[model samples]
Target chain A: MDILVCIKQVPDTKDIRLDPETNTLAREGVESIMNPFDRHALEEAVSLKEEHGGTVTALSMGPPQAETVLREALACGADNGVLISDRAFAGADTWATSYTLARAVETLGGFDLILCGKQAIDGDTAQVGPGLACRLDLPYVTCVQKTREVTADSIQVERMMDDGYDILRLPLPALLTVVKDINEPRVPSLKGKMKAKKAKIEALTAADIGAEKQFIGLAGSPTQVVNVFSPPPRGNRTMFSGTIEEQVSQLVEQLQPYL
Target chain B: MDYFLTEEQQMIVETARGITEEKIIPQRAELDEKNEFPTSILQDMAKADLFSIIVPEEFGGLGGGCLEIVLALEELARGCVGVATSFAASTLGIFPVLIAGSEELKERYLPDIAAGTKWAAFGLTESNAGSDASGIQTTAVLDGDEWVLNGTKQWITNGGEAKIYSIVALTDPSKGARGASIFVVEDGDPGFSYGKKENKMGIRSSATRELIMKDCRIPKNRLVGRRGTGFITVMKTLDVSRPGIAALGVGLGQAALDEAVPYAKQRVQFSRPIISFQAVLHILADMAIQIEAARAIVYAAARHIDSNPKNMSKASSMCKVFATDMAMKVTVDAVQVLGGYGYMKEYPVEKMMRDAKILQIYEGTNQIQRNVIGQELNKEYA
Candidate 1:
């Protein structure tokens, strides 16, 4: 199987701070890590390559520093890494980002399968996978919890659901957005580090990937961020400071409306 | 001085730090309190190929050197020194074989070690021989086609658990240091037994026990180097390994800093965080400076050993003495930064302080390191 994993670098949510005035995240001093879900996607892709004999390529679209995630993927067993970076690619929404990624995929030639994380943690919109699939005109599955089987022409997977899951089989040249349940990512080995240090990462810009300027960046077809804010605190909790029986009766009476 | 790590080194540091945080730190306090060897964490480390980092690739290892060892240990120590030592002592045990063993011997032993399927331990410290290695009483005698070893080795790391042991003993008592010879002893050999495990003041999670070898026999082919070169082999191994101890010290010191800095910022006193006070700020600043200095020296020393294995005694001693003493001071001050809470066992700084004390005492006490440095200085200046 020839697989491509689309990854992103996002600010670690644990250290995230809000810029209340601008209604945006304060990115300063925040460490960036590979999106948690993307890690599972890459892990699944690498395991597939190991099981069958083929190559796994990790591709990402971000600033130059985003090469760190690509290198990290290489260290985790990706056979190749490509970074799509350019100033023109800045201020991209999900539609534009997926459009540019589709162009990069074309430049690298199409793969039998494309894998992605369910969503990036920093931006929890979960749109890029489906958007990219739509742009590529390929069948796609989201919330893939397990890969049942893979062959030259088709692949089978279990799509997760609130109650359980649905098994789906898609033809080759399909896309998948994986969840954390897919697999546990392996730690990068020392030998892998040596390989990553020496490997030359392929860098592509908009022109390199043959992407049109209008469809590639902020000007691309389109959604815009109007405002971002933390939800107001909900003052819906009540505390009963009384003896056990009194507290229980008071709690039951307070919850009587919902009951 | 600012140091820029190579890409490979940075990846190594990141990988080790991840494992340390995920696997080692969470279990450290419970392991210490129970005084149990951290077998699961060590196995996790092995699975990560940490044991293979310094072994030759031909022997199924990563072909890394002293710098790689230092990088890994510094990160591991940040989580827990006992765990780091438990892992590092294996490297110490395997060095004699890598340094002087015949190809046949290396082929026999290193593959299992590099594979992390087995563990190795170094046996040199005896009851009569602490700093004075020449006073070791373990004796090895050639009988027919085998060498018989008989003596008790005290304070051995990984004593009963390790599958392989690199031990030094006297072959000719009259020649003192010249009489020493190194031998590879297997754990399951008849007459090889363990004494009671020591209850240590710190690094308690590591297993420290006595290695008792009474009438233990091995093929003469297991002898390392030659009959009289054991002392030389032992000294060179220590020289190569001292930087690793320094790296552990750096790790502990950095952990202390990691703890104190965060607590200082959030801990309120007198209507403000204590970090706002100049006294506390100076303490934090001093801690950072000291740790950085120690780290720089330890990294430099490790690189020095990697590049120039010869003439590293003085540099090794310098780094070991400086870094370990610095760790002791830094951890103590970290406790002071938190004041009364720091003294409490519930917080981590107290455990860090306990861990820091052993760095100065083991791997050749800081006093012995200074003596080695002074002796080298006399030779160089004269």
Candidate 2:
């Protein structure tokens, strides 16, 4: 089985700053880390590969610098890594991003499984994995909390819901969007690190993957950010001091006229 | 310039750091307060093959170089100095055997120690021979096929818990340092027992006890290196071990600085962040400079040992003296930066300060290191 984990490099949320002038993210010098959710997805993929005896390949679509995330994934025991990077892919909404990824997957030939985080922290748009599956015409599962079983033919996963979880068994060549509750990521071993350092990340462009020219970059994106701004300062709030009972009585008296 | 660590070294550091952060740091304070041996910490470290960092691969060891061991020690010490001390002492204890032991001895002992099933310790310092190692009075008498030993070793790290001990005993009464011979003393030897555990000011989680040997008997084959060469062997081992201690200091200091930077940025004084003030920034800048310099020197010394093992006594001692003292000062400043909060036990800098003090004292005191440096310089001139 060949397991493919799709990950993203996002600005660390803790380190993020906003540019008030342009109402855009200030990315300069902001440290970028592997998406926290994607780490769990990568861990799941690696664990499956370790237990089932297969190759784990990490795939990422971003700017050229995104290769660092792939290297990090490789360091965490991925057997191989691929970078799908191109300027034409910039400003892509979830729809275009998924289409671009599906094309890249097609170019990679056959894969037994595909895994991704439920969402990217920067965008918080949780549509790429399912949209990619739809485009590729494969079975898809979202918010997987645990993997009950995995075989060459099929996989059993526990999908998380608001109130409970559902265990679903899907055939191979399936796609999954995982939550952070799956498994702890393994630290890179000495051998794994050396391999990662030397491993050549095969870079693929939209043209390389045979992406339709119209379905790339801003031209392909349907939604646009018209404006982004911080919320305005709140009005002064009244204070209710003293004992809880006295405060409640005073508040009721004060509000009697409005009632 | 090979700026990157070797693949093996990087992996060891990564694995050791992960294990330390995940398993060791969370329990550090509790273990210290209880004076526990951190059995689970050792078990986890062993599971990660940390014990094999310096062991030859042929003997089931990691075959890692000194720099690799120092790197791993730095990460491990960042979590808990006591656990790091225990782990480092085990590596130190096994070095004499790994370097000079016969095939039979290495085969019999290295596997278990490397595998983490058995812990090893080096016993050299006596109550009277702290810096002056030649003053040791422990006697080893040849009795046909066995050697009978009698000695009391003080402040032995990992003392009571070690399964195997590399002991130095005087084989000839008149030859002073030249007469000292190294021997492997196994636990449960009829006359070998441990004395009281020392109540330490810091690194209390590490087991430090007196090693008592009253007419202990060991096979003649257990003699490490050749007779009358134990002093040199011990010195060589210290040359390797001191860098490890320096690395520990680096780790503690790094942790302190790491914690302090964020804290200074967040902690407000005079209606503004302390870090915004020039005075605080200068302190942080100085600390960063010292830490980087000390780490560079330590790594250079470790690499010198790995690349050229002939003679590195001066370099090793220099690293030990500089790195350890730098760590002590850096940790103290880290505490000062935190102010009242830093003085509390809840803050890590207090513990780091305490831990850093021992590094300066142990692995040869800064004063003793200077003495070694002076003597080595004289030898060059003479």
* Collision pairs in model 2: A190-B11
- Per-residue lDDT tens digits for candidate 2, residues A1-259, read 7988999999999987889898889999999999988999888888888788889889999999999989888877788899998889988899899999999999997899999999999989899989999999999999999998877799999999999999999998899999988876655555455667899999998889999878877889898898987788999878999999999998999899999
TM-score of 2: 0.78
**lDDT of candidate 2 over B1-382, digit per residue (tens):** 2447865675777788887787888898888788889987787677567787788989987788789899999999888888899999999999999878889999999999878899999999999998899999999999999999998999999998999999999999799999998999999987999998899989989999999999898888999989999998998899988999999988888888999999999999899999999999999999999998989999999999999667899999999999999999999999999999999988888888888889989979999999999999999999
- lDDT, residue A171, model 2: 97
lDDT of 1 by residue, A1-259 (tens): 9999999999999998889898788988999999999999999998899898789999999999999999889988999999999999988899999999999999998599999999999989899999999999999999999999888999999999999999999999999999999886777766677788789999998989999999978889578779887889998788897799999999899889998
| Weakest lDDT window of 10 consecutive positions for candidate 1 chain A | A184-193
Best by lDDT: 1
lDDT of 1: 0.92
Please give the C-alpha DockQ score of model 1. Answer: 0.34
Best-matching candidate per DockQ: 1
C-alpha TM-scores of all predictions: 0.82, 0.78
